[model samples]
Target: MKNNINIPKEKLNQAVSRGIEKGRQEKPMKIRNSSMIIKRVASVVVIGGISLGLTFPVVVQAFPNIESAIIDFVESVLPKSYSNKLKHESKKNNIVISDGKAIVTLENSTLDNYQFIANMIIESDFFKQYEESDLEHNLYANLEVSIGDNKNIVGWGAHIRKIDDNKASLVVTADVGDIKLEDNVDVYIKLQGLEIQSNEWKSNDIKELKGNWDFSFKTDKVESIKRINIKDEIELDGKTMTLESIEVTPLASYIKLTADENISDKWVFASYKIVDNNGKAYRNAQIDGHTDEKAWNFTIAIYDDLSNIESLKITPYTDEQSIPSKIHGQDIIKMTTTMDEGSEVEDIIVSRPVEKRDLNVDAKPAHKYEGEKISYNLNIDKEKKFYTIDELIGKSINTGDGTSVTIKDITVNDKNTTIMLKVNGDYNVLSQVVLFDEDMRDIYSGIYVTHKGKWPSNSHWNNAKDTHYASGLATFIIDKIDVNKKYKLAVPIQKEINLNSGHTMNINLK
Candidate 1:
């Protein structure tokens, strides 16, 4: 599969070797597992497109003045791997503006329906005194968008490359939904508050610097786009999930998915990939938003050439709903007692859980707890793999909200505890599952599988499974559970509507 792509020969050889080694080490997987593995490798190949030598089509179209030196600027701002993927061409609109403390020169900008990307240069006394690392911690570009009379602050990220003691080049970007140029709209950006103070990277850290350098621009041109509708549905377990449409813009691709209304079982459509006629696949980069009731919108960064994209494949995920039963201890017997400095085992009585029951909300057991507390005593000489759980228990939980989740089972050992969850509500419950001790500090669980660009990290537990179509198990880990201390499993409450307001200013540039 690597040989089929246009990447360099040496990289292809490396990829093939890695794929083969990975395939050999994996436990027995489904028949289609090989195909999925190949697709994953293909996506990685798309990211390393520096040597592919494909011309930057959209970037070239917009930014004609992009020089070879810009490559160095890009490398300074982004990760070394992403320096090569920066857009070089864009719709050239060299608009410049300033706010006394700094001067900004907007060299070019482009709009891809969903997002706005701009190329600009900044000259300021505030930036001249800082090093690249200092600038990274201190500098930021604040952006605001106004469509007709509807104005609001937008979320944005920027990359800055220092050009000299007082100047730097930048690429600022923001995702603005459902943009229509026909509406009188304007974008305003400012570079201010340049100061450096660092500890750990906190999301809500406060800033103290006060330098006001601003730039504002508007575009009258709108690319004519036609969205393609592919209303397709996949059904399983008496539920239906639908793929509503695919919007392929010049910059990226968008997919719309909707779960059938009023369905009880949580449907996860995890697999969203675009396959070209040549079999090259593109993975999703970020989510746009939830467009309607039980509907989601997502975007894919089409970094690779998209001349031959044929269709989008939406695969259904498999569900794991039952827990495994216990096994006998004597059937797995091996011995070698580890003697502590002054301790010795006179007689060993191996014990296991004699009873199990499913639990409901409020910690009520569905059945009476019979016999001893569920446990297993291990033998020292036996390999850890040989020691297995002798009892399994499940529980059902209501998330205070209307949603409810089922704790299909739990297994604990000296090393870690694994909790398997099955959401029985209309929404995906995996992202909402939080495990905390009585003190309420968030515990860090080992990341088994995390989908890139997921809003909350580890939102999708099974990358191999089609998450949107089926409910897959979520496994959480903790070193050990204390029988005396209280533990709670919860999904923090989220506001359905934002009621807070922010400051806004209307500045006119002559």
Candidate 2:
């Protein structure tokens, strides 16, 4: 009506429909733009809130709880070995994580029942990993115990920590007994750390451990001991006795002996042939005592018949001696002798001297007598003593006459090389006679003369003229000469002899 124009109904309707469709599209665009702007603002707020939570101290503190809960859960679920490994790493790195804790204690109702006691504590962390790649951590405690009683019996107590797959910490304590011992004893331990997986968190952190121990006993039948060595002041009496070399057959039966050196001089020893129950003498063995410092040792051979020997008797050499000389055991016996007081031994002796004889010597010249015809006779006597001619002859001489004299002998005093000679009639009277070897060089001259024989009186002759010479009556004792060599004696006599009308000069050597 307003258009007043008959615009067709289809055209009007079409325009209206197109306009609605366009409005619908435009509305959706406006809604989309508004939604995007609202979404971006919400995202910024969410990011700011997360950042604030991280920076706040209260929020950080809250996180530790969560971490501790997670570590505890993991420790409860992990294996003990695995938990221990994580504990060690955390300690080395100075790291504190949420891990479970363990505590151990040792208790005694009566403190007097224990003799010695000790306490020990340890702290460690625990951790574990699961089959699904999950991890957990924990802590634990252990206790060790050692106890001794009046009966000389010992007891031990130990608590072990174990982590299971459920992340649970299992504590187990074991009490063991029947430890009967008379002396000291020791225990060895091996420890390691590791991680394992379970249902809850568990800590391998081993904390408070009680290692305190106690020992107590009454000093009842304990045998007192003293060491002794005996080496000197003892002797063995037998056909053949070895002092230190002898030994007892079964060594375990012999008890170590004891003595004091200050008192050892009073100790003595004696041995006897042991007799068996069968009346047969045991091996003729003997025992010797030896003392090294304050101890005594006895050496005895194995008795051939030890089984039959019944008893051995021992008595000190003196009642005042404090040392016990007799050691008695089954089938074995030892005896000690007594030292005599103020006993002394004498010194040794020496021998006397013998006398030697002196040698005798004599010398004389030739003589001439007047009668129908005269001859010289020289007599010599040795004064009943051992004498040599070289001791009387002195030396060699050379005269102006063309003659040389040498004294020599093929053998002298049983020696072949020594020679002795004398010349009376001389071409040249040799003032000095040189004794020589085969080479003719001088060997001995001064105080060495050549002659052969023995005289009764060298200083006093009974049957000789005023001028008488004996050339052959001298003897020589030679020393150190060769046996296979030959020698010669050369004598140069005067070419002429002067005789009176009825007198002739003669020279004789005897």
Candidate 3:
């Protein structure tokens, strides 16, 4: 939620100096949540890297250059675009703190406009009691951070793992609000508590540690955020949604779109799928977007480098089959280190990342919705056949293009309205669901869950039948819908195919 002005492309190549939490949420989350654990909208996000410092750090009289800054984390944890941005911002630090019982080190750190990661290692005799079997041990440390003279208290989240009986590694990430990296950036961390967790035993905790781990280090100021102005429009829920601008950086691209008529109130998360010219697809976990609701601006963070992208095929997708439910696969990561003789442990290799694309280009999506509509002109009166919400539960409506939906149930509560539906026929992706009032104001209902019908276990998208996964539950926020006013349920003639011809805009970066 830092200042976003959509700087003009001609005036942009300069460094972007603010700090942002690198996750897809409505805004940058502060670190005070359960110490440093940050939550993302699409997936659970944590920082990366490991650090070990046996002694207090001295100003590395000779600062380590970019090549030696443990840049491997960028390659491993981040998308290519993010790694590229953070790789330059990384600075090596060996700050150490100990309170007789345990020790922690701030080994390496990086900061840019989008986010920051602090690589740390904590060692204590206190952890020796927890024995490791075939299972892995994890130690989560609750830490808080602050940046520069602004005393901006940042939020943090950690990914911690026990490396040895007495040692553990952690990647601490957080959001430093409105701080400029060009200034003398000083970072302070207060180590609060440590939790020991594993499959076999109850978690144990060590509360409130003594001396803090405060460190100050400077990084190269070379963040290049590429801004491109675009004026492409796509129809969403019977309205024109404009793709206004896109700002690309190594960390992530900030894509701004304006929804017609200020959709701020009825907005659900913008679901967009991206395919590069290489046919490499990027979606789900790597993409996160939010709307500030002012001027109807929606900003999406696509964690990839799009500055010089020769061409792109981007679309607002609603099909469950199009977006991944969770992270799928990983790449082989090997970490090699050189050490002197007799050191307890000299090297560690930890791997984490993504997965496969497609069996073949000819493969079609498993479930996709055809252009369809729900009659918006119907009045909800008890005298009408499908007038009452409860009366419509067992009713079936055909979408004309070989798709139909049967309502299993509809739940109305104070918070939201939930409709359980069974989709019948070919159109498995049920288009965009909405609730329309007599005045024709559309309220988008979010489909939170989709249960695919039973099918062969290994069936890919190409061979999957429409009936394989035919039903889903979509919910709309129309708390206790006004009974006096007439409203109708609808599937707003959504297109699942990639926007083609006039609907899509091609950007040639040459």
Candidate 4:
């Protein structure tokens, strides 16, 4: 069976020549390795006691007869949720094929109604010739796996574990495209060459380690596919948006929305989620794409049974706001002060129904300005439902510059709570703000202050302003707060950009 697998003549010749050298060696060759480095700030600090409960109603059952070797490999590589699903749905498939230099063993595969996964191991003595320079973003960046005729299935994700210094096991997954699989039809599995990312993280180098690693398997048809289409209209802030369709399957729910051509103001939503009739909340809502100038699409992964949901109520943001940006790190100030750990300062009170202004601030060139003086009683246990009060200012340190962020006032009304802030020195300092409980533990960390207007489409707040100061609001949905309990706020002194290497994958089942 191995002799029948096809390999390009050049790759076969290279493998044979390398094999001759391996035949004479006393032991396998070793390659010097340089691992990838990732830099990120801790988003959440799990302090003592306080915990937020996030739950989904999915029932997971273990799949019997899985190979112990493959189960161990899969658990090591994939995410906990994905690994659990794979374990429950996988079937054992023991198939081995080699191309003289590297041996690949297919251990198990899972075929869900909408997804497919393959688990395998690759043992290659030839890999020793390449050193750390041949490594990619991590390890496995070059490993390729596919299924169906003509390599129709490209892998969506892969988890790899190096067993020894030379061999590795990989689990690859794909979202089986829109095309339905036929019963007993041949499903071809193929492993292609590997790519290595250079120092610049670009795929400029590829190792042509080719082989005839192929297998044929039969698949029984799946019956769990389900979908629903609903054309519903939703109104927000006097603007109308249409929910064109809602698709529900075992894995996810897809929602489509479109705007009317006559509408002038475009709407965007944040903290959006669907609550079913049973009061269970699902917050997996993600913006998939903007279909056109007037339309948008989204996807929400549903882990529970679709039938368990009778109706859904969705929360959408109606009000949009914008703030301009300012220059940073110029004429920086420094100050050191001492205060009681939990002290009460001063407060300026305003009348009820304070003047509400539209969030759209006009764009202008950056300028330095002395912001208005703000003061507030540092009281966290005010029982007033709404506080029209003076700003509670905090000093932040950024690159030797002391910037000030003032919480102008606090409003607790309805289910939405907003924190209005004025940036006196620099807007970048407010990039990270955390609400900490008494023990210096986080109640909410990594809170992003987003604008509603069209100026700053990018995620950065600095793009919205070129001035010396800016003001914006961060809104959150909560039922009620325990104001009696003490809390503290923390913000970064300098601007920070969390480094992220973006890699994309496309899945087309059809």
Candidate 5:
């Protein structure tokens, strides 16, 4: 196996600081030096805890069986939940892209069913000065990622932390596209351009820097992600709910759920809740899904510990008001887990829901928002307004200033209209592009703000070149929208766009 990124020789003490995970006792953070930076993104903070309840003494385990040496990276940035699985694994790369002014090298790398990830080490004296600059927003990486000849699996990169004074580590993750990797597949990355921003990270981007960094190599290794068989059907308020098997890794748990066939395009669901048999509550569900005319499948990832969990008590909720057994919902699903006596540390097992359970939360709800990783509290419209997903579906408005907002996905329940809005181009100008009613009021129950998007490939690429992007979710009042009528959208900040609706006018979509 040819390594594309190589770690430079250095003492272990020359490392950067990482934020500690809340509420968990974690082992010491390790550092490893290496090469390259970005198809990067929002900072992904891994959440997990150490249970110390292992039935037996366990040594630090690797993914197992593979021969590629798990080099001590410049920083072992793997999430605590997955630290055991990925701690010792890293791709030793030798390919370096340098334009004489800067360098990008691929270092620690791993793969799963979702995408490929690599730690990119970058060293540049000029760029390192941004850490002390008066500007809060200084740099951005524009990259293109490809996997085994896929037409468009462009990846995203992110800045993890500043290491030594001359170096910083970046992580780039690319979607797997429709193709599947078997034994081995070649991967490629290109740093098309480097951008700069003077305002907030969401501000307009200016491509002021240029560099040539490209690396590619082939390897047969993949992170050990396991799927256990779990099949059960339960009846929800009005639809059929099926519980599929869960995908487990040292990083997190992906719980698979399916709704009844041909459910309406817009639907309602009880917010889900899960707890360990020990009464430890798991809140804040992160959701991803597939939607079509006949199928609606969802994968919910729980970023926490799953070991020592004799069983899991799963419950569904509409909101916090109906909590602690006053649930108009059904019983919790008590699931049994399985594992070989001595499997690899990465090989965790979770069995099917063996029986129904009743979980009661004793404390007040601690989690704020549920779906998207929102930063602030959105004021709920309070009115139980409903809207169909088709009202303004697929509509978009692009300003001449390079700022645009697209209506990505929408779901309506008896209580609110949740819209997934994708903002592209200039980030600072997002406050100007507002969704409104005929009266031009910013009608929303609560506004879910988004910044880095956690770099999930769930948004659109517009079949265009790489640039800065952000997204959000907003819930609205008004029982439903009149899909039969035209809707007005505004970009009030860009008044120079010359609109017929006057200076405060909005772009109308029929």
Candidate 6:
């Protein structure tokens, strides 16, 4: 084959050189004939064999079996760890275990029912082992298992297998809504890597289990029984009564009660009493009640005497008969009573005075009247009437001259009415003369007395020596007066007098 191939190559090269020489002989008439000859020779060698090998090199074409080729390619491209993992997964897919009855259904005709059944068995076992290894100590004890999206089981279905002496593997399958367990129990579930969404949790007996619970996701509602376990013994009037449902919240210290009517209207006609464990009447126990529409709500603070009140008795009075009902052994009680027609309840709280005591007992001094020297005399032994200094001052009257006239030795009903006058050292003239009663009203005129005294000059009065004249007759009518009561008497004295040369005088009455 090599000799034949080399022979074709040599003959092709000779044919090319002959064609070039023929071209050169035919084109000898031109001056470029020699250059054309040389060019033809180089082209023949290059295109004929040596350059053909350098440009279009040889390539061997051989193929192995198709299956083995694919396998080898896959193995060569993938990492050793990944390749081993795929092999392990393929082996795991073949081995199947079912924790419960495996239900297989084909909704779409494209899916193979047998293949789905196998897949579910594998998934169930995987979840079972996962839950057993993960959540053994959780409070939720029961377990259920299911496979695929089917309605074969309406409720929870679970299966268990013995794993060890003390522990067991469990598989659970249930819907994502409305799941509940019995009291004091918990349920743990694993659905491969699927998430669950639920709303409510409820139990029949909250007292036994204690209404305390924890949840992982937000739910719509949870119901549980709240128990009031009495710490101390209480006396009940009856065996049992329908208790009003009260909303009890977690971690709250006090119990709250709501009513449908005004508390005053409901409790007013109902006589209620609360006694503590010691059986003492509570004092100042506050009872507050409010009204909402036709209903009454009341809150009563419990005290120590009212403290630990294990019993409460209520009595209602009616026209037909008196009905007495008792609610016993409850810290918080709520009830309603009807009000009588045309009758109303009144506030029963009363006001009382707080006690106080007196402490001091000392006397104060009397007040002195402000005036110049004035005189007064009283003769109660002779008159059987009262006379005070104010009455004497009322009898005095001012004269136009520098002197004033006053009654002397005035008597009323045999009582001596004495009088005295106060003359300032600067007073030099008098204005008018009139006698006034104790009320300061003019009762008599002292004109006659002033005219009788006559205007006397300081020189002519040298021998007078500030003398006072008195008359034994009654000078002014007087009315009965009380000594304890204060009275004012007005007497007009000197007016507008120039008394640069001051002089003093005195007048007396007896």
Top model number, TM-score: 3
**Ten consecutive residues with minimal summed lDDT in candidate 2?**
41-50
Winning model by lDDT: 3
lDDT digits (tens) for residues 1-510 of candidate 6: 001011233443344334334432000111111211211100100000000011101100111122232233223222222223223322122111223422111000000100000111111222232221121111122222222322222123222322222222222222221123222222222222221111112223111111111111111122222324322211122211121222221211111223333223322332223223333322111122223344333222221221224443221211211112211211111111111223332311111111110000111111121121111111111212223534443343332233334433222222212222333222222222223333333221121111113321111111111121101111122232333333323233223322211111111110
Error in Å for residue 437 of model 4: 20
Tens-digit lDDT track of model 3 for 42-76: 22234444442212122111222212323432333
Q: Per-prediction TM-score, please?
A: 0.43, 0.13, 0.46, 0.41, 0.44, 0.13
User: lDDT of all predictions, in order shown?
Assistant: 0.37, 0.23, 0.43, 0.36, 0.38, 0.21
Candidate number that wins on TM-score, 1 or 2: 1
For candidate 1, report its TM-score.
0.43
By the TM-score metric, which is better: model 3 or model 6? 3
Alpha carbon deviation, residue 315, candidate 4 (Å): 5.9
Better of 2 and 5 by TM-score: 5
Write model 2 residue lDDT over 400-509, tens digit each, in one string: 12322223332333321233333322122222122233433222212111122222112111101001011111222223334333222222222222212121111111
Give Cα distance to truth, residue 124, candidate 1, Å.
Answer: 1.7
**Residue-wise C-alpha lDDT for candidate 5, range 306-370, written one tens digit per residue:** 65566664554433221111111222111111112232223111111111110112212213212
* lDDT ranking, best first: 3, 5, 1, 4, 2, 6
Segments of candidate 2 deviating more than 4 angstroms: 1-260, 263-266, 273-288, 314-510
User: Candidate 3: how large is its RMSD?
Assistant: 23.0
Q: Model 5: runs farther than 4 Å from truth? A: 1-77, 81-90, 125-129, 132-135, 150-157, 164-166, 174-179, 199-207, 223-226, 234-237, 260-271, 283-287, 316-510
- Between candidates 2 and 4, the one scoring higher on TM-score is 4
